[model samples]
Target: MSLIPVDEALARLLGDVERLRTEYVALPDALGRVLAEPVTALRTHPPFDASAMDGYAVRASDIATVPTVLTVIGESAAGRRFIGHVDDGQAVRIFTGAPMPDGADTILIQENAERAGDMITAMEVVAKGRHIRGAGLDFRQGEPLLEPGRRIDPAALALIAAADLTQVPVVRRPRVGIIATGDELVEPGRLRTDDQIVASNNFGIAGIVHEGGGEPVDFGIVPDDEFAIGETLDRAMAGGCDIVVTLGGASVGDHDLTAKVFAAKSIDLAFWKIAMRPGKPIMAGRRGDTRFLGLPGNPVSAMVCAHLFLRPLVARMLGTSTTTNIWRARLATPMAANEQRQDYVRAIARNVPDGIVVEPMSVQDSSMLKSLAMANALILRPPHAPAASKGDVCDIVVLRHIT
Candidate 1:
């Protein structure tokens, strides 16, 4: 069978996926959730004309000339409003955010007005409606506060609360079930034999799921047995997991039982063996309502695949419009030609005056987790690409979401 192209495989994996059901959650609990409904203003902001600065509210005609004296009849501060009008030769002491008094069309900033007991003298001419915020200036009633599919951030939460919303409708988070399979694998912190290694892929995958706004459920490690794998798969499905991810046991080895177990369960296999290095053994399929994804056990491969595939899948499920942060950068070192499989070379990126410069790590082994951790980006090398020299432009996907 031909290996599926990377782009084609991803397209197939995300086929027909829609946003999860919407649920109303309290404003405090809505952070990082994708909005499912548009939030509209419940009431107008600045309900009445308000003062934008601490000053004297006066008629524009009265303050048309500098050094004009007027009697201060009353004071307005924020919540309090001056009921009396500002007729000719009259002024009201108004602080910032205070409602504008009746018949006051202009404001003379405190710096431009001198006060003497119940009297203020304008020091400078002021324009009409100056230093005053009109009613509904920020937002009006019935106006859209935020659109659907917007991820609620800190500022978004504040805006929603200011809109008089106690609750917001957001897409339900997708639940991802992760299963680790390998007889030679043991849980971290447990005593393991020299030949055994700790099961670490599941934790990394789980973190990716969480970062992508999905709830990750670990199924623990199942020994390399068909029955054990089948039992764990059944439990994950019965537990209402939307996506099931299995680590290891995907290759055509005697110990590999993931394919057999999933096949026994009659999973509708979409594709397997993507045209990419380190993650070529990836398996994708759909079973009932839950999607199945089999990832290679190599530490770096699992994470790279998650970055390329799983993150976007979870974002799609949450109805968030997420795209890979791919950017162009100048190569800091020479690179050999790529073969049939596309390569994701771990690299370090630095912002230079000209543009971003990326330096690929000397070691490109798939088992090196340290290199992957230190890499902030992955340089993309397409199949059959020509050899590249230093200072050549290359495409890269940023790993960290730096603000």
Candidate 2:
């Protein structure tokens, strides 16, 4: 089979995918979830004309001049309204957030007025509507506060609550099942022989799943046997997993059994090879309603593929937008011409006096997990690109958000 470009592979993988179902969750628990429907204001904010500052509610004409004396009628604190009206030379002591008393059109801040027994003398001139928050100043009833497909961040949660919504309609999070294959692989903290290596791709992939808003269900390590791999895949399907991610055992090598097992289980294999460095052997397919992704056993390869493909898939299922987080940066090191496969060069990015500068690691091996860990960005190099020198502009995908 011919190799598929990275972009084409992703297009095919997500071509038929759709957003999952919606569920109602409490506002407090809606953080980081995507809104399934728009949230409209249940009632107008500041439902009544309220005070915006601690001051005396007086008729604008009463305080049009400095040092004007007015009789204090009653006090209006938050949650308590002054029943009396401010007529002519009368005023009402009002606190912030308190409703304005009847017949009051302006507020004279306490600092601008001197208070005595049942009386206040305006010390400065004031205009109409000063310090008064009109009804629906922030939002009006039936107005849309948030739209669908919007992620509920801290600010969004506060806005939704302010809209008088105790419960929010949000898209249900996708559940992903992770299966690691290889007889030579063992769980972390377990004793390993000279021929065995601790399995780490599952943990890393699980973290990616969580960060992408999906629940991860680990199936443990399955040996190279075909039956064991098939059984685990069946169990994951039976468990109602939306996506099934298999690490290692995807290549055409004699020991690679993931492809054969998936085919034996009647999986509609989509594609197997991609035109990308460190992740060329990645495979994608579907069995029933569960999506399957087969990643290379190399630690760095699996992570790079996950960031490029799996993250977007999970986000799509959650009804949220996915971003590449790509930024422009100046290359701090020289690079040779790229081959047919696109390269994701792990690099360190730093903000300098001029601009953001990125330096790719000297070693670009697929199995080097330490280098991947130390990297803060991935310098993107397109296939068949010409050689580049230091100080050249390049595209970089940020791994962590910088302040």
Candidate 3:
């Protein structure tokens, strides 16, 4: 009904949110998914003491002195280990990842040894266990390696695989239905009258949803008609969307019918009109299990709202941390004071010698998509803050990595 602070709005949106259902997926499909359960090692890594280099495995005492000749007893390669033992003054030709032969405590790399027939001369002294990977060097069987709520990245996937886990329990990706509402908006590349503009918010919102680890279902564009918007909302709810994102028609205007349609569906409006610039008209609600977010029609406003609200919502649903990328930076130029609403000024962030310096774009109109695209950070100005001069440090939400 009334405007609320951005932090308060976010708290309401995710205060009681719970993680989605868990599903077991193969390791290959687990990337980017949050683990719903801890992953334990099924088998010990390296199973046994293995050589880490391609050379001779001998007793460290035997190679304590250089230029020592030792009789080669056997050869050990990956998967095919030498079954014999290496007695004193004896060595075993070993390859990387090969199990070290019994009685061998170190490896003399081939580069540091000269082999002639069945004998090899150690050219350099190698420490005991120098090139040998001890049993369970990485992890032991039944040891917990990955904890719950951990997102499966490339390294996590590899770790799971190395732990002998073929399948992993991960939070199911939340299904997000994205709808664009406006009669003046048309699909991209479609024929449009001078009064109509191409729809772009849905695509950007969908990308944000995906980047947040949610599956985005595009409901296409709906006209300003209440029935059309209501029908789309019904379909999204029926389709079991965990979250429904409506692009545009959030403000109370003649053509704004999204909120009306949501009301007809008995959606419990959480809060509307946050005390923030660029996205002041944003609204959030929920009906049954499907949460709804009505973002401003302006492209930049919708995107910023998505980053601030939608991203955290998805992360919460995935049982992961909802930390944002806010950082501190010094202002590169002077900035005017703000009013009651907090300002998110899109700007270019540069890595200067001292620290990160942000220069606000000259024009910060919410409707300008080009400026939003060119921005790598958003300077956060609190409500009713005083004007700031150059070099004043301020908190910023980093949109892109500062280079």
Candidate 4:
């Protein structure tokens, strides 16, 4: 029952995800993986100096003096370029995205020009290089655009396509195993007595694993016997999982045998019992290459610990280095005091005129999963803190949508 500071516990959990490995994936499959190397521009954008509007390309000197007129020599549409250069006192009728002819230095927008037969008049003065997209304005050839460890998003994928890249080097997803322990827990569809509870925490943890970019292998529920716990863990480790999460029995109850099983399996305890509410029984260790996490039985405690621990581990596994400790808007309603441990209170965020408004969920029992279902954020209450008034800002955790 040793107590440890939250910051110190987090510090020991640092490093690359369980293991880092690189793989070549197509652009479409690189959605959330980290970029192993920087992406470079293959060619200059706009290729050549081009018009930015549907107007006339002319020498600035010809239109600088307001109310100037010039004869239209040629036309340049999108696919068509006016090969001939513009001579003095002459202009080229060019559409947007069309390359500027050799002798043109500026473009007068169509709204500012009046046409009379083949000649046009500028109603206002125009400056040099106006309404023109210079070569490589968007991107330059040989420029490093994206760096390693950067997560790939839709915009980034489009940028890679624009750079003419078909494949990218990204970190691979790690496989994780989840096990729930307790005689009181039964399978989702199993026949149960009133005293038996549903084994829902593993499913919640599996969804969390998927959200964190890892493949979850659920081992169902293991009984309270030490042999049953050991059997479940042995299977997970032998199955080659990168991380193993065993829910419940992390506390020192008569039936709490997760720690004893871990010792038998040669797990080296990294740290346990953080100074946080709901998850004070969290036990972290390592056995061989597999990272071990033993969480408490209460539903909210297990899930919140998963958000704080497992999610980050998977992100690191994918070389993302993403930090999930997030922000929450000031509370619109007051909250109660906290005990000696940090408490995570589930809350909902709403849109308001000034900014997002946060409201704590009415039912905050540690054993209730329904409260977390309607929650968008979790408000933090520091140890030994008194009750808070409305408008008090606090730390939060944003739960991502699980696919």
Best lDDT among the predictions, by candidate number: 3
Question: Cα lDDT of model 3 overall?
Answer: 0.93
Q: Supply the TM-score for candidate 3.
A: 0.97
Residues 1-403, model 3: lDDT tens digits: 7889999999999998999998999889898989999999999997999988899899999988888999998899999999988888999999999998888899999999998999998999998889889999999999999999998899999999999989899999999999999889999899999999989999999999999899999999998899889989999999999999999999999998887888899999999899999999988999888899999999999999999999999999999889889999999999998999989999999998888999999999889999999999999999999999999999999998889
Runs with alpha carbons beyond 4 Å of true place in candidate 3: 64-66
C-alpha local distance difference test of each model: 0.91, 0.92, 0.93, 0.86
For candidate 1, what is the lDDT? 0.91
What TM-score does candidate 4 get on C-alpha atoms?
0.83
Q: Which residue ranges in model 2 land beyond 4 Å of their true spot?
A: none
Model 2 TM-score, all chains together: 0.97
Runs of candidate 1 with Cα error greater than 4 angstroms are: 401-403
lDDT of 4 by residue, 1-403 (tens): 5788766776677553444778889988888777878899888786899999999999999887879989999999888899898988999999999999999999999999999999898988888999999999989888888998877888998888788788898777778899999999998888999999989999999998886778899988889999989988989989988899999999988999999999999998889799997789999998767899999999999999988888888887777765875765678898878788878788887657766667888888889898888888888788888888898876667664311
Q: List the residue pairs that clash in candidate 1.
A: none
Predicted candidate 1 versus true structure: per-residue lDDT over 1-403, tens digit per residue: 4798899888888877878999999989999988999999998886899999998999999977778899999999998788877788999999999999998998999998888899888999999999989999989889998998998999999988888899899999999999999989999999999999988899999999998889999999999999999999999999999999999988888888888887999998888899998799899888878999999989999999989989988988998865777999999999999999999999999888888999999998998999999999999999899999999999999997422
Model 2 is weakest, by summed lDDT over 10 consecutive residues, at 316-325
